[model samples]
Target: MRADIDGLPVRELTGLEYASIVEGVSVDGEQSPIMHACGHDVHISALLGATRLLAEHRERWSGTFLALFQPAEERAGGARKMVDDGLDVRIPAPDVAFSQHVMATPAGNVHACLGPSFSTADSIKVTVFGRGGHGSMPHTTVDPAVLASMIVLRLQTVVSRETRPGEFAVVTVGKMTVGSKVNIISDRAELQLNVRTSTSTPGPAC
Candidate 1:
């Protein structure tokens, strides 16, 4: 069992009152707003429910259960950190590992996929360099925000123009960090991208 505790640094969009109340999350001393855009909260709740049920009704089950609580799925390092902390030596290795994800579906419906249910994902960070200057002066400064915007637009064509017609690919600029103040132009812009490569085939219908 695994749960990702980290949230994306995105503003809350839901008007519901049960939305995330956390103000900001700090990463490497820099603080930024965050929200649970991913379905990690559902995964964590499911894991907790399963654990409680198994514990409360031990007689209904027989085998040992190992609950692995993990964090930093956004950084993609939680499992690796656990392994590095000697997870193998801490307990007996299970016969198999199981992972479940929550997805939107019809009520009371459960769906599963054979082979790779999700595409291969990759994360990339790119910093667009520029020359910072006062906002009052336009021509003097090379705005990285402008550069970032152009790069992001160009990245959109990577899948459409480069990939084969039958194949599938994606490029997304998931996160971008630019100038802090409206009156100042930043010297650099940080960009985080999540790219997925499709792994589907034209299979026979049922």
Candidate 2:
């Protein structure tokens, strides 16, 4: 069994009855609030409890019970890091494996399904280049901010028009950085995009 133990770099809502009070410095050396918004805390706790129970009743079962506590799952590099760190040689490979995630379901309810239950996700960063110049000189500069905006608008059509009906696909431009000031046009603009597609869906959804 495996459970992710990473927390998201997001601030909790104010005026909540059980908001996180702890503050920590992030990997970038900046102070930020941390919260388990993805329910990885619940996953870790559940895995610990289950491991304890199985340990106390080891006589009832026969086999190795490896409980994997993963990290950096929010960035999606935890599993790969573990493998690179010699996880394969340290632990025995099992015939079967199980992992769980907390979903938006009612309490005391557990869901299980065969085949692919989760969607495939990808993160992409795109940078468009242009010519840096003063905002007053419209003819002298190529504006990458405008190009980035055009790309964002065109990406919306990938899901709405290119994707077939009933197919599950999402294309989101989460972050865009352009010029620093209104009077100046930057030479380059950066875009952070996230794409998600259902595993069961056929063809390229995005």
Write model 2 residue lDDT over 1-206, tens digit each, in one string: 88888877788887688777668998758798898767876887899999999999999999778888999986789999999999999998777765566788898998887876778889899999999999999689999999999999999899889788877888999889898998999999999998998844466545
Clashes of 1: 0
- Compared with the true structure, model 1 gives a TM-score of 0.80
Give the C-alpha lDDT of model 2: 0.86
Tell me the tens digit of each residue's lDDT in model 1 across 1-206.
66776677767768789887676646756576777768877777778988999999999889878777778877888878988999879979778877666768875688897766667788999999999999999699999999999999999998888767756677889889999999999999999999988754433444
Worst 10 residues of 1 by lDDT: 197-206
Q: For model 2, where is the 10-residue window of minimal lDDT?
A: 197-206
Judging by TM-score against the true structure, name the best candidate: 2
Instruction: Give the per-residue Cα lDDT of candidate 1 at 5.
Output: 68
Pairs in clash, predicted candidate 2: none
Residue 35 lDDT (model 2): 81
lDDT for model 1 comes to 0.82
